[model samples]
Target: MGRLPLGVTTLALFFGTQATTGSLETASTVSAAAMIGMAAGAPLQGQLLDRFAKPVVIVCFTVLQVATFVALAVAVNGGSATWTLAVLALCQGMTIPSLPSCTRLVLKRAVSAGEVDAAFALDTTLMEVIYVSGPAIAAGVTATWGPQGLFLGCAVLVAAGTIFFVRVTGARWLGPDPGQAERAPDKEDLRPRPHDSRHWLPAGGFVLAMALLAAPFGLIECALTQFGTEQGTGLSLTGLILSVTGLGSIAGGLAYGTVRWRTGPARRFVVLVLGQGAAITVVAVLPSLGVVWTGLTLAALCTVPLASICFHMLDLLSPPGIWMRMQSWGAVANTGGHAAGVTLGGYIATAYGSGATFALVGLCAFLAIMAAMPALLNPSVRRPEPAKVGAHAE
Candidate 1:
């Protein structure tokens, strides 16, 4: 329920603002501000989730999120200034709950070591489902009740979902008291630890790899949209082409989870990155849209599996108590890479066309593969012994 409303709220922000202000530029500015806010706020919010009680942090953020959505809806309807709308949008993004990271943290505690890979993969697949279906639901809501109704509906859904999630997961998985965890010894402390120099190389390398892995996705999305426009194919066909990639990711994630691979996540990570890059490069040179669709779908088979691998590796590597924070930082890296890819892709698409933009997407993937190599090469960076179930609960 919480995840589903995100697409509706996002669409309401853009289309509702455009409807009221009659300026695409204003809508774009508001949307960009929200993205910036999310990128900036994720780490901080993660810290809060790590440091405080789960229920308190979640409830507080939900209230703020609901208020921001309602305020933005009112402002848009009132024809408020662009700056005011932007501020509200930014607040909304900042307050948007980091439920995915929270879920990962819970899974780290609730699932057995033997089941970790499959659990994470299932989580990744669910996320893919949300991304694919959320927009379609948003479209339906907007068509029936308009953007204002959609915004109101989003607010209701968020509130209801948060209450339900906290009620269901709070006592069972989140632990009885975060204070007990907080009062544990220094070795068991839940606070963010000071950085140790020895771990920097692997940690920094992992962050860089994640960023690089994400950039090609943004580039390809922009390139595909431009390709569709250039072909004069309508939005419906273009959306279908893009949806194929999501479907591929869902399939890949589910299939990956069903297997028990002998190799470590680090090795699998590098292989998947290289394979995806090679696939994209091969397809980018092709002239036919049909081929592009097929190639992208094949390439995207690596997407969610890569995410599952990354998160699993994170679980292996992160110091006890900082899992959520590390996950948030991972999100920040992805957001940054995606923003850069979209910016570069836009300029390239405008100047050189969609084909060139697609080529750049391939280049970004190869660059990511290079960034990931250090993790594969560094023998000293082995996974730590698994924590006992419920060892790091909040």
Candidate 2:
């Protein structure tokens, strides 16, 4: 909830703040810093949660997150050193709550096993809807108020959500499931048993796949803003384009959940990813924003469903106690991919243009899909359809 909106808000902040700052490059650097922090931050939080009280860990990080946002906003607005701005963003990233993973973890306590899939479907769908609305909300907030006000609003939202999530429910929300007595809180238990070294291949494969999928999205975010700017439509409208993509994804995710694939999750993964790559490439070739929007909508349709499949596969593959670790690593992979895309795309769009940058992202995604083919074929990675997927899921 808080995390999705914050991410899109920061994108608006970065794209919008370039006017006050000397160069778009500096703002991109600042956004990249946050991206790097997020790439590493969630996993760090997961590690801490393993040893400490959940509420304590979340509270401390939430405070740090707020302070970092304030510091970041000040630096960006005051025309402070770019390095300083980037550093604060990095600090802020460390505290960005891994809300999606948290929601999935807590759902069992909130609902029955049979209904968990429905809950996750609803959760993932709703999250996409938030992301769909995030840019629009950020644009509106910035227009009505300002980028600084937007940043303040983000900080307040994050702080409030973190407190509510951690305090309102108490220990049971964070406690271990009572029925799973065999699932001890041991580091070793997180790994796929009897195959400490072997699990790495599947894990690595998943990480890479997720990263590849995410890179295009990060690049697209930056590219869309630049494209909108170049067309004289303004960055705010570009944000609206993203909302359209989100709408497409909502439809796709819902459709994906209804259709039970005849093949395993891996097979489905290959198809969806390749489809996204093709669509992204189309986005690069097209000249008009309307055409790009069509391509973006097509790409968005595959995005969530594929990610859902990946997470579902990983959950099946993960050992009992290490669910947090596994999910954290996946988040790292996704964020890392996004960071690379954003950083690189920002640089390319600054140096060349959005068209060239779009091409580059499309090519990279295509290459990644080709690279992932071998990895997806791994025997250990095979799994039935995701629980939250269609009713026919095995």
Candidate 3:
């Protein structure tokens, strides 16, 4: 439910900005504004996750997000000026916390170490499906009614989704209604040490992993869009490429579950990560457009699989009750890396060309591999302990 609103808003934001602004520079900046908004809110959202009932937080933020998007639509279509857009953009950013955090929270409870990989694969695949479907829906709306309609429609859907999610998730408010005393503890305290040093390691490692992983793919996305345009493929064709990638992600997720890989996740992760880079390299070096497209397809195939493995690793590794926070942190890391990638890619593409930029993407993947070597090599990274269960007031 959370996914629907976010997906719709993102698509509308990206496509709508492109239509209204007509300048890649402006559109990219708008996109960055939205992303930065989300990034800025991550830590606060994480704190909320630790403190509030997941469903309540989800519903509240979801409503805020949809409403903000509506305001944004009004600002953009009504010509309310740049300040209105900035305010709406920042408000929409606060809504970014609920969806991914909820998914990771569920995984923490329902999935065990053995199933973490499959869970991540499934999660990544679902995210891809959302990306594919949402943008197409936005495009259809945009095609019929112009870009502003896209935002209006997205806001409506998001609002509806939030309502539905709250009703469905069966989340109750955590604290005493208004003024009741908190529940008494019946068991020993299971909370972390107030000054625990160990807690930082998992968080730091997860963040680093996501940052590294995001770099290549982020740059590749920019380069691929350029590549598509260069190949005389229209915007519709670019959409098709992304949709095909989503289809591949679904297949990859199903296969990950079916295969139920027995070996440690690290090897599979490294292999798929490199494979993704290799596929991008093929696109960079290959002469024919067909080969390049095929390479892009293959590159898409590599994405969800590696992400799935990493998510699973994180599930196994993070402390109990910290799932939402950790997930948010990973997301923030990815967003940060993507921002960096865009900046770096733009610079490199301007200096050398699109093809060389793709090559640099491959180099980023290599660097990520190197960055993760310590955890990837150590078997101790996969600790198999259950998170101690107790009432966390928050």
* Distance from true location, Cα of 55 in model 2, Å: 2.9
The regions of model 3 sitting more than 4 angstroms off are: 17-26, 111-113, 146-148, 171-195, 199-202, 225-243, 285-290, 377-394
Backbone clashes in model 1, listed as residue pairs: none
lDDT score at residue 78, model 3, on the 0-100 scale: 68
Model 3 C-alpha lDDT per residue in residues 1-394, reported as the tens digit of each score: 4576566665566676667766566555666677888888887887686677766776777667767767777766765544456566766776764666566545544565455556667777888677667766777887798767777776776677666655654543322111112223234322222245655654476568778778765676667667666677746665676677778767766776545554676777788888988888776787366876687778777777877777666544445556556667777877788778877876776677669888887787787777677556545343332322541211
Ranking by TM-score: 1, 3, 2
lDDT of 2 at 50: 53
How close is every model to the real structure, measured as TM-score?
0.88, 0.77, 0.81
lDDT of 1 by residue, 1-394 (tens): 8766655566667777887788999988988888888888888888887777877888898899889878876887688999999999889878888877777767766777656777899998998898788778777776677667777888888899888888878856765322244245365432233355534556567778788778887788778777878888856666887788889999999998887665667778777877887777766788477778778888889989999988776555555456667788888887788887888888887788888887777777677667656555554223432444655421
Per-residue error (Å), model 2, residue 235: 8.1
Q: Which 10 consecutive residues of model 1 have the lowest summed lDDT?
A: 176-185
| Residue ranges of candidate 1 with Cα displaced over 4 Å | 175-194, 229-237, 377-394
Residue 206 CA displacement from its true place in model 2, Å:
1.1
Candidate 3, position 298, lDDT: 80
Model 1, residue 243: distance off in Å is 1.6
Query: lDDT of each model, Cα atoms only?
Result: 0.75, 0.70, 0.66
